[model samples]
Target: MQFIDLKTQYARIEPELKVRIQAVLEHGQFILGPEVQELEARLAEFVGVRHCIGMSSGTDALLAAMMALEIGRGDEVITTPFTFIATAETIALLGARPVFVDIDPVTYNLDPAKIEAAITGRTRAILPVSLYGQCADMDAINAIAARHRLPVIEDAAQSFGASYRGRRSCALSRIGCTSFFPAKPLGAYGDAGACFTDDDALAQALREIRNHGQDRRYHHLRLGLNARLDTLQAAILLAKMEIFPEEVESRARIGARYTELFQARGALGTDVGGAPVLTPYVHPHNLSVYAQYTLQVEDREAVAAKLGEQGIPTAVHYPIPVSEQPVFHGGLLGADYPVSAAVARRVLSLPMHPYLDEATQERIVAAVAKAAGL
Candidate 1:
């Protein structure tokens, strides 16, 4: 089965998608077109934010957010190491050091307890990633940032549709960013992203930062990049939005079913070599979109191989922590991130999508159970 059944999703929205794309083609305003503005407005409304600045890619969105906050050389941004490279890469790209923090062993997100200890005089901002489609503890993180008088940027790339408490993912912090990569919960056909904020100044700054720092044509207010989201992608996303709420519900249902099936098969706490096979630990206050239904198992490679033999596809969300990446020179500035190190070796993702069916899910879980020797 496909890891993410985009083909099925496309078929469901085909007619509306065609109409939206056709309008974009007919209008011919490819860059920052009408569709882009409309999509931005809708997304902002969905997230309960004042502004949503569409970007060319999630990476650029992070970069623009940092730029808007004036993060640069000699500055430090506190963040977790157990996330996609883009989380820390953008910080480093801006000549800012990414101070690594360990993750909560249960949620595999930045451990708020460790965040305060990492802050120093040079700390410019706090960035927390919502990994595996669930939000990090934004309330705690925001409190810490408030104490430090720093901005908090929530990297909601994997959790655009998720909810923390009663608020949406992209509306929980000073600046929130999310990706529209094809595999995300609310993905577009191609690369796209957005930055959301309630601060009008930061919103305007983000909009300018994504468009060569121009407030208007030929007016360069600050240095920026050509990171505006394509009109076609916005059109496609707008069409996708029509059914996104339903898809979010499906994802939550499917995720719960996967956990329920694994537990019923006696695979929840079963030992897989050294480590026990563990399901994702979502916090009670958060509603995850379940972008990837991941598990922690010992001998991950062996487990993945066993699943593959049964014609089931599996993936590793991340095999290496950013702190251990070669570019970071092996734990940059010589800090220890034991939790990130451990999680990196055990995390494995299985097929997850809103369209996944019960029978297919049973087959996948049975494969996992057998693979784990349960």
Candidate 2:
């Protein structure tokens, strides 16, 4: 019944987490501790990247990557609007324009066909978000970037463990960033994030940027922010990493089961398959970590209310497109971003986690079916 069973996950890793934390306490290197480097190393290896620079949060990771890339005023970063605000906020923060692109209705990711048209002479990078744990069309995006000689920054906040065409999410672009927010698929106990890249110079620049642009002790190389990941969070992430692979596999299994159940009901035109509900889509060359088991449902507010009445928790990943947000109002208007607008009105997320039990899942499905009046 819980939306994301963190308690069960905590129970599973309690002993290891305790031990990891105790080690951090004993070491007493609270900031930029050995544990942080250890975590970065493990994460980099996992992602098949040459370097991973840990930071305070995913937003900071994005900002740091932009800073390292020298993205500045008048520079434009093309991205989809059907995602969390952080994806666009970071670009705006650097005084760069976030060129909004429509999404693929089925995948809820940036539509590559729509990307080239958004590109202008000011375009410096392609910032594609891997929404809800599935990667966008990286190959297509990369092809466009290559043609323009632009860097690609993969906003992998919700897709830490996802794979695209045999490559990991965070290792697919010039620089990739992911969050360790507790709600993310692969998360630490608190705010933490990492930037991944194979380019040594960019990696070096990111390390300096995360540490206030210091090339050496007190020698400021460039303007930067104090974005270092804390020792405690690093320890927690290390503990979580021990079992993350298994958890990802478990999540895939759960997703497959949900797909089977929903597709069966959908084919039968049952309540769950009624006009209100549309299942998520997974690409053939990619694997989703199922960070959010989302559905496209009609009258989302009413469906959510009905599910709430049944004691089944449901939430929206995003209710408004980032382009329409108050902060970015009118910035992307007249862009004809039809798919992003449509997705914002309909997306609903159900309880999803590796620890989700079968009985609880069935109850959730039943409640949804009844709510949809299938």
Candidate 3:
């Protein structure tokens, strides 16, 4: 089974995808074309935000957001270490330090309780990741950011369609960024991303930043990067948006079904529940899109190998915490992330996609049960 099953999704949206792509080809405005504006508008409306600035990639979106906020050398950004490196890499790219914080073992997201303690005079922002399609505790994190008078950027690359307390993922913070890397829950055919915000000034700044800080033709307003999204990607994303809501529902259903199937075998447990496998624990207030239905399994290597033997594909969302990456070695001083460290060693992802049939899902789950020796 394909880990993400993008092929099935492509088939589902083939007609619309072709029409959109053809239109882009006919129009020949490959860069920031009309499709890009249309996509930004649709994304903004979907997220309940006032602005959505299309970008070249999720990494660029994060970089542009930080640039607009003026986070640079000598600054610090507090973030979780249990996520993909892009979350922290963008922070470091701006000549700023990424202050590592332990995650909430249950949700695998930034622990809000530890956020305040990490804030210092140099802390410019709080960057929280909505890992594995569920949102972080934005309300609690926002409260802390309010106290510190800092901006909060939700790295929502994995959670574009998720809901947190009735709000969408990309609408949950001062500046929310998400990827469209063909594998995200709501993705384009190629590299693309967007920055969402309610603040008009920040929105304007983000738009300019993505176009090399140009407010008017050739008039550089500030130092910026060429982070604009391609029109073709925007067209493809627009077509996918037509069925995104339904896909989100399917993802939620499939994720729940996976948990139920695993539990029926008495194989499911919490992060610290001592059972051989731990299922994802989403907060009641949030509706996860389940970008990946991950499990924390004992004897990870053996379980993966067993699954492989049965022709079942499994992946590791992350095997190394961002804080422990060689590039940042001896850098994030005084870091002691026991939770992220532990999760890194144990996490495994199963096949997850809206199109996964019930029969296929059962087979995959059974393989996992046997692999974990449940």
Candidate 4:
């Protein structure tokens, strides 16, 4: 069984995908092509934002957003440590410090309560990651940023179609960056990303930054990186968007089934009424796209091994926290983020996708319960 079932998704859109790619080929506008602009416009409209700048990759999108905001040397950006390294890597790349914040144990997102304590005079931005297809608490984060006159960049790589308080993920902050990697909820065929914002001036800066800081032909306005999105990827995304809304609904239906099945076991004593395995928490005010159906199991290794034995694939979203990474852990001790450290040792991800069928999910869930010896 495939972990993400990309093959099924590909088959569903194969005809459209072929036509879109062929169109790009026929036009021969590979870079900054008509498709790119069209895609940016569509993405902006979808996110309820004024502008969307297509980028080379998710990492480039983050880098370009930070560059557009001019976050560099001696500046600090507060973020959670229990996420992919790219969230913090881009900050350090610009010679800025990534101030680590502990995650909300329930949401696995940056805890807003700890954010104000981390902010200081050097703080330039607050980068909150919307992990596992759910939007972070952007309202609180934005209030803090507003008080400090700092920008808020939502790392929305895992959450494209997610919504928070009726607002879309990429439209919830000063600048929201999302990925088009194949596994993301809304993805392209290859590497691609986008930066969304309501500010026109910042959008202009980002457009220039993606094209090597060009304000005009051969005019270098600032130091920048080549981060343009390929026209082919844009075309693929435009096709995918046609079915993206229903796909998100499918994910929610499947996710709800998984939650019900796991909660019915009633073996785990941690949550009083829930099962032993702790399923993901989607706030009442938000909608998650179920990028991954993750569980916090006491014996993660045992559960994963058992799933493998049953021919069910399982993965670990993250086994190490970003704060513990060697490149950035110079002064941070392992105990600093106690929650991140403990959560890292227990998280496991099961096969999740919009096409997942109920019978297959039941089989997978039964395998997990048996694996845990429940």
lDDT of 2 by residue, 1-374 (tens): 78888888899889999999999899899999999999999999999999999999999999999999999988999998888999999999999999998887778888899889888999999999999999999999999999989999999999999999989999999999999999999888889999999999999999999998999989999999999999999999998998999998888789878777777665232232223337777877888999999987778899899999888888898988888888997764447677778878888899999988788888877777777665
Instruction: Please give the CA lDDT of all the candidate structures.
Output: 0.92, 0.89, 0.92, 0.89
lDDT of 1 at 18: 97
Estimate the TM-score of every prediction. Answer: 0.97, 0.96, 0.98, 0.96
What pairs collide in candidate 4?
A: 268-276
- lDDT score for residue 353 of model 4: 95
Q: Report the poorest 10 consecutive residues by lDDT, candidate 2.
A: 267-276
Candidate 2 Cα errors over 4 Å, as ranges: 267-277, 332-334
Candidate 4: tens digits of C-alpha lDDT, residues 25-112: 9989999899999999998998999999999999999999999999999988889899999999999999998999998887789989
lDDT of 1 at 94: 97
In angstroms, the error of model 2 at 152 is 0.3
Colliding residue pairs in candidate 1 = none
Better of 1 and 2 by TM-score: 1
